[model samples]
Target: MWGGSGSGVDYDVMEVYHLPTGAWDQKPTTGTPPPGTWVYSSVAIGKDIYYFGGRGAGDSGYQYQNSLHCLNVDSFKWRELSPSSDYDPMKKGFCGIISVHFDGEHYLVIIGGLGSSSTPKQPNAQYNNSFGDLRCNEIHYYRISSDQWISPVVTGDRPPPINDFTLTPVTNNTAVMFGGETDNGVSNKLYMISFTETSVDILEVPNPGGSVQWPEGRWSHSSVLITTCSGPHLLVVGGDYAYDVWLLDINKRKWKELINLPNNVTRRYWHSLSVWSVTPTTNWIIEFGGLTEYTDTAVIELRYTSDIDWSTSVIPLDQYQDQLRRWILSDWENLGLSKEVQLLRGHLQDRKREFFEEQLQREIKEKEQIQQDRDKEQQQLLQEKATLSQQLDDATTLLEQAEKDKSSLELEYNEKLNAKVAEILEEKTQVEEKKQIITEDYEKLKLKVAHMEEQYLKEKHIIIDDNQNLKSDISEKDKVIAKLTSQVEEQSQNEKQIITDLKEKDLHIAKLVKERQERVLKQPIKETSSIGLQFNYLEEQLQTKNSKQDTPFSRFLILIYLLFISFVLSTNYNSKQFIGKI
Candidate 1:
């Protein structure tokens, strides 16, 4: 039996009543630490109920607890173990404490939880914030034989500091942890930690799309692992002051949401959840009292049965009704001493039927309203369709006109390009004729120079042979020399004339290049102007067609508007006429 006081206490107490003969007996307190000591971790070893690590008698808000106490179930006697100074260095709250018999000896294991200190602040002097202080991820072990604490060196990427995560022993050395809140302010991720003699390996379960997103990150949720016919499965229920329940397949490492409890059920968190295999084929998971969001006075019991395939089993609505029917039938068969109760039940059932009918009518009315809304949407769609059809026709006409303009512009551009090509050919012919004339003049100058050199050589030989008349010969030689000098002067003049001609030709070529550049620059602008004119002309024609089409469309719209108004008026008139006839 469980009862709570109206005082705002952090912990609520529960009395375990053993009713073998249908009589109640109050069990004595195990350790009288104080009133309101919130029990966190408990395990039954033999006849003694061992409790570990719970907050007591202060509003420090669920701080780190170190007390270890045991209650003998047979005699109801309490024994308190001395607190140890040697812990895992990190003080933690909501740590996973479990009792496992390894090699015929009992050992208590503690895992990750909220640490004692806040996170360290960053180095910026102006922004030393306190939000970083949080939890630590560490594992510690306590040996029952030596009554001593042993810190085992477990290796792996330690999980982020989090609390309220479930740690269920899947096997002797394996434990699976699922959804919990982290201190770094992130969603909870599913993690599994396996232990060997040398190290611990933490593996993350990958969520390939679908509804496998971890149960919305929450804390203080209860989880229990049980061996079913299909194998071991983890069942989690009522988390972070909520009413949601979920199941996790340990072998598959996937979570499946469970059906929500009925309205009569209460939401709870940080509750005592335990699984008991009632039969080989059936398991009963029970939830005891916990603090609800509204008040701590609330007490609720939720029992879920686990079959072979608990993940796929869905409780049918008909099954709920059938169970109610069975209960009613059983009560009626046992109502021989109370006949009036059966009549009351019949009256209640009739009232329930009437309420259900009223609810059904309300649902029908809502559906009819939804249908009317859909009809209004259909009418709007029809109007939009007519408008779109008109726009499509206008667009098609514009496209045709644009095509015609484009073809005409292309024809004009080709004609202009052909004319320009002809002009370029005429200029090229003129340049070629000038080059031929210059080459002929150079050949004639070469022939004249060669003839003058031959004549000078002959005069020099004649003067060399006449030795008798030396002065006369000298005069003749001077004459020959003068003739040769004049010839050389003429040849130099011809060569200078040829050089000047070549320079003039180079100038002419440069002028032609400049003119060609100017023409090339102007051609693109001229083509663009012609194309622009064509585009403008097409646009005007398209506008005219669009305007003509718009007149008909506007008339159609006006007709539709007038028809709608007439329909509305007629509908109202008919409605009034019918009312009058009635």
Candidate 2:
């Protein structure tokens, strides 16, 4: 019995049929029970049915229930087990729990599941960020006798935290875990987890590519282990967005997807799948419950035979159909195996034998075909090997010739490189010497200009003072008019001599400036060089002064200064450009 919609208020009751009395009884627990929830893990061990974690009724955090309860099938009584103090029930739910009997003791094994947190049931909106956390990967074992939860030491390539996976026990010590949802996305990887007395080891099964097309990635699928005459294999059923069935061959470690099944079988998730029969004659995988486009209450069956083949048969009855519904409500004895059905079974057995014979013959033919193909491939390989050997010898001869050519070219390149380096070094030495000479001349010119500026300022001050004295001595100036005239003439002669000397000095400066300009013009401007930067600064200064107020004398001085600077700049620019050509 389980709870469904309407806030989980409606609990669906199960009908149990008594085999001997041929009577049906509606069974529902009367005592206090676990909360109504979804996605819970349950397993039946002997007469007790155990239930674990799932989504409970409420909102957000209150929605995940962590209760563990067991119902007695014989007495219809519910009992809750109290784990040790170290074990917390709230965090114990929502894991893939299974009961396995080993060494005469039953132990409940729990695999990965959703942790104690709240998340959106369906994260449809793009902006919804409600993914919680995944539970631990360590396998948790609960001892039924001791009532203790023990986490065994697990080693090997531990799988990432995942949930909604199907873990079916293949044997007492081995179990196979199929696809599950992870933080990254849905996974289709399969692993074989082996349990021992002290430790657990998990090994990933490789899906080597071959003729068989593997199943696509999915979660919330159903898988159950079944033993066949060939070997043990897992029968996987429908999952989210899937209606196809696949079989995982344990011995071969490969997948073979089932096709051509009845059309009524559709994709399902949160469905129950189990091994319905383990008889040698016919084995069956039964699927029930879960949603497919909407709520589904259909029971489906898959029949397997010793010939290692699968077929689906419709039971012709469902949970809702009243007519022929007694087929589901009663045991096999109540609706005894009719003679017609028995005859059909016998016919199936005959067909099964015929299938095995045909299959055997097919295998022999396939083997012979494979052998012939292999021999043909071997002959082709030998011929190719001989052809490759001849080609390799030719390549070796060509390689030697290429090596000789490379050595000659390398020698020629080295010689050219050495000559270029020597030429560059000689040029560098000449440039350094020229730089020293230019720097010395520049220093001399700078000192001379400073001296001239100082002398000009002193002479201007003295002239102004002399004019003021003449104005104050006007009366004396008239009485000594004759003496003043002679003094003026002498002063005029001295002024003329000074002017002549100044002109000669200016001419000397102009000559030196012209020579430097000629040298500068021989080279191109080196934009990043120190001399280039100085030239730019001087040009700016000349421009600024020319733009400001100026007298006739100052203007003439500016003109000469600008001419000298411009000539020098032109020379440097030409020199640098010429050097680049070299």
Candidate 3:
């Protein structure tokens, strides 16, 4: 079971169930930031939990927030830190927070955050124009002694402009940041940034290429610097859009990819990772949910072997005490306090009996519950087995019956097929016998037809030759008759020609008699005028008649008609519409 502080979206403090037998009753400090807020840095020093440089609240579309808050583990109280008197303002967003304890003093270092700078753009800019630019690479130390934040000058070159990078305290003075998205939006570089009591140094760690790179270039990843059997190693677990487990050997400067997490473990980012060393051999790292691009409240656990690497061993409390008692008694004897050591040993024995009795009763109750659950599961398995056996028996019987039915059907089908085959064979034999007899009869009929055809052809040839001789004789007689008719027609034509010559001579004689009669009549009429006068009068009358009928206008009329004819010819040539010419 899990518990959290705050109501609505601002669920900040997360409590996990750690006790084995009792219900979880722990609560986190109230008024912490909500669960979905991006907690960029966190470090636990002693019993204090300090978180800084997270962004939430306001209307800046993810306000670049810079506030430091601390949780007292015993009191569960929330404390917010303000800007130091010397510093300009409480730098938010871009700062890196890491906890370090050196020389018996704990300090929370805030380095490189977005702070007050020149306004980025003009007032009338179309884009969002609030928050100033990133500040210099000054590291501010929160000294727990003075309860004040101090801006310390960082030595060497500063890290490139970046936000949301993970910082893990490898030693009391050194911290490693790996694979965080820069302001330019590129990830995948390991940076070893260390701070001594005097100065800070940043070194770029070259990547050793392999199937996968170390510090797997991601933003909002959770990492914890832990001491294991192999010495101080940084265990980098989940991150934004990553599911691989990576372990960085800080001492050896090497890296190893761990096995994949179980299905129940979430591969997420921007979550809280905390390491609590319960014993010298066992250290448990608890991860509470943060923004997984959206709000997430998934909690995950990872167990690491402690530096001492103590294996499981049981030591009876009585035996442990007896050894301590003997050692203390020896020291007392040298110090002359033997009587007091014996009294202390007697008191421990009396309390041990009562404690053992209580432990025995609790163990008995737990064993009984375990036995009951085992019995119930065994009964269920038996019932399932019985039911499955019965079903299998029924299936077997049905399958046997189906097989018998199939066999009977197959025999009947075969018998029917055989009877059909026998009937077809008998019909085939009768048809073959009939076909042989018909073939012999066809051959005899063919010979008889051939003999009749030969006899008919010989008679047809004799008749054709006799017809040819008769046609030749008839044609010769017709030609002789045609010659005799032509000779008779020629004699008739000669007689007719003689008759036509006599008729022509008679016509000539008649014409001569008519001409003589005309001449006699003309001689009688000429008595009234002289012959010359009659000739002149006739010539004048002819000339006057020609002039009156044909004037000069006739020539003009002829010319106009000729011109109209020419115009008609040209118009006919130009008039292409009738022919549809182009």
How does model 1 fare in lDDT?
0.59
Lowest summed lDDT across 10 adjacent residues in model 1 is found at 121-130
Mind giving the per-residue lDDT tens digits that candidate 3 earns over 52-151?
6545555556544445666677777777664212233344454567877668887777765454342232121112113355533446677777777555
Query: For residues 263-327, what per-residue lDDT tens digits would candidate 2 score against the true structure?
Result: 44557776776564423323444455666654433444454543556665544333223322233
What C-alpha lDDT do the candidate models reach, one value each? 0.59, 0.66, 0.58
Order the candidates by lDDT, highest first. 2, 1, 3
Which residue pairs in model 1 clash with each other? 118-133, 119-132, 119-133, 119-134
Better of 1 and 2 by lDDT: 2
Per-residue lDDT, model 3, residue 524, is: 50
TM-score of each: 0.45, 0.50, 0.44
Candidate 2: lDDT over CA atoms?
0.66
**Residue 329 lDDT (model 1):** 49
Instruction: Show pairs that collide, candidate 3.
Output: 10-34, 11-34, 66-92, 94-113, 95-113
lDDT at position 19, candidate 1: 17
The CA root-mean-square deviation of candidate 3, after full C-alpha superposition on the true structure, stands at 24.1
